[model samples]
Target: MKPTLNEQLRQNIRFTYNEALELIVAMGMAACGEQMYAMAQDYKIEMDPMADSFYEDTKARLSPHTFRELQFFFGHNFLHKTLDFGFYVSICSNPEPQSADDWIRSLEAVPAEWMLTEMVFGVYHDKLEELLQGRDWEASKGNLSLLAALVRDTPPHQEVIHTQEPLLECLAHPEECKLRYMQLLSQFYKDVFIRWKEPLKERSEQASAHYETLFAAKPEQFIREIHKNEPEIFISFPAAFHVSQASQVGNHFLNFTTAAGNVGWVIFGIHNERVFGPAADREQTELFLKAFSDKRRLDFVLLLKERPHYGQEIASALGITPAAVNYHSNFLFFLDLISVKREDHRMYYHLNVERLRELLALTAKVMLD
Candidate 1:
């Protein structure tokens, strides 16, 4: 018989920190300055005050031009949340780069064409040939309209840029686009690296000690309890899991990379107050009820019940925007009501039947026990 999800987690999950991962978070947040600031301010009750402070301080140090470029490259609707960048970073042979300069070199080694393809097409890059059958990607490599149309129609079930201008410009000079990205990261590093390195190192030590001890003591309990606050952190059953502490991001950020292996990386910025207590049946019941409370979320789950669907398909079926679909999907994902399958780089969502059954049973127990 297959091991239980809890057992799988205990066997596969590990806690550690990588400064390179933290730098990506920092640069991404800094690029997302206003948005990050607003989110931190709005979620201050649950966010670390240092998160906002980190963004503000780092923003003050960068020149206007460099900061704007950063936003264009990594901002949410810009390059579609920088998954292409992060994915490449995670693939570096060296698990942890010794310095910011070393990290830059690793990024430098990424092929210009591959970076451009991944940036524009996202996960579809790997499967473009298969998806298009015999059609050659090279033929349309310079056709911005065609690529944009592909992105528009074949949604990867994640946030993606809708604007065609950035991709259009990049296709004209893929190498330059890549070089400029490296340059901006370098500049961002110079301005902010010194300030961040030590704090991140110290936070890593503190978080590692606290979490590892808790996890070792009760592996099953630790895996189940860390996500007590679904609104803050979400973890699905992954082959391997990584938790990184962030300084500039909001309360929660989740990223997946298949470079070295399938790894689910969840980054949590310093939280001023967080507590993991005994599981509360009432809280679990409330979450179950709340998850189904929204009609859109319910519709999304029901849609997946018919068959696995990508983000754009779900949005089209529900008559909502892709971004809205992503929003609802996150909450469902947090509840583990949906499981993701990646085919050729695109994410497809399937309803988690077992999790659904367990939740219904748990709700019954909570309500009638």
Candidate 2:
């Protein structure tokens, strides 16, 4: 007898995290933290002027080389099938802690061309051969910004013709840039993670335990049980990059990943459904109350509870524009109360019963605690 596709998919899921992975993720997050610099005052997180400039410089060097690279790092499901631009990281293998030295070695081992390809072609990696079948990269430097000049000098431009010279710096030396940036921030990384060591360890432990329970349960119930407010998850496999980072910021979750060899990320957000359960801390409870207080949001939730509906359909049902529905949908999505599933080009939204339940339960627990 043959197993079903879902079984095959479920077999791939694993409960895992590693110190090395966390370190890299932490570095990336730290790099991106400057964007939320203004919000630090709310948490009383000190904002250093010099640190802000440093993060800016770091972002420029580590900037994603391609659109696909950007999508992966931001933890979006956006991907192309030709390259498997988004592969599932937690599916096949469990992650184990790697010493700092081992992590450096792992970084060193990453192929230069592989990193370049991820930045340049990414989802369109399969086309790299055809795109540069016989072009001399060094020779085409003069035509950096002009596709026509490129075609005149190098015939290959006539193939998938276009100009993207700004990204050339990245393609030229991806490995060097990546390593240098990581090295530059090594001291800061060491200091920050060391300071947050205890919390990181606790969160990592909680994540591992939570996943253990989920894996032991039925696959069909996996999404249903994740968080009480989690809308019925209908996302495709290999599309999510789930990172397990223990941070109070990002609501204990954020989207981030760069194509680590054809894989997408799924952010478990440390405060994962299993680990933190449905409990919303003080800050989150305030946010939820404000978001949930709206009459429109209330109607939207009740509507989704009945069945999954696309933005336009939901809007028509609620007597609002699709854009308005989209806005509200995004808020619900951020709260994990709703999820999206693509059918053709349309993204259908449905209630996450688990998230809803968790939100209510946690709201109560938080109030009492």
The number of the candidate with the highest TM-score is: 1
RMSD of 2: 12.2
Worst 10 residues of 1 by lDDT: 231-240
Clashes of 1: 0
> What local lDDT score does residue 309 receive in model 1, on the 0 to 100 scale?
96
Q: In order, what is each prediction's RMSD in angstroms?
A: 11.2, 12.2
Candidate 2 local lDDT, 1-369, one digit each (tens): 876544644654445555555554544445336344544444435544433543454455443543224222322111122111211222212233454445555545556454444334432334544445566543533342332332234322222232234235444545564664345335434545555545555566665676666645654445444422232222233322233543323321112233443232344544344233433255456667878788899999999889988888888888999889878876787677888999879988978999888778767767885
CA lDDT of every candidate: 0.62, 0.48
Q: How many clashes (backbone N, Cα, C below 3 Å) per candidate? A: 0, 28
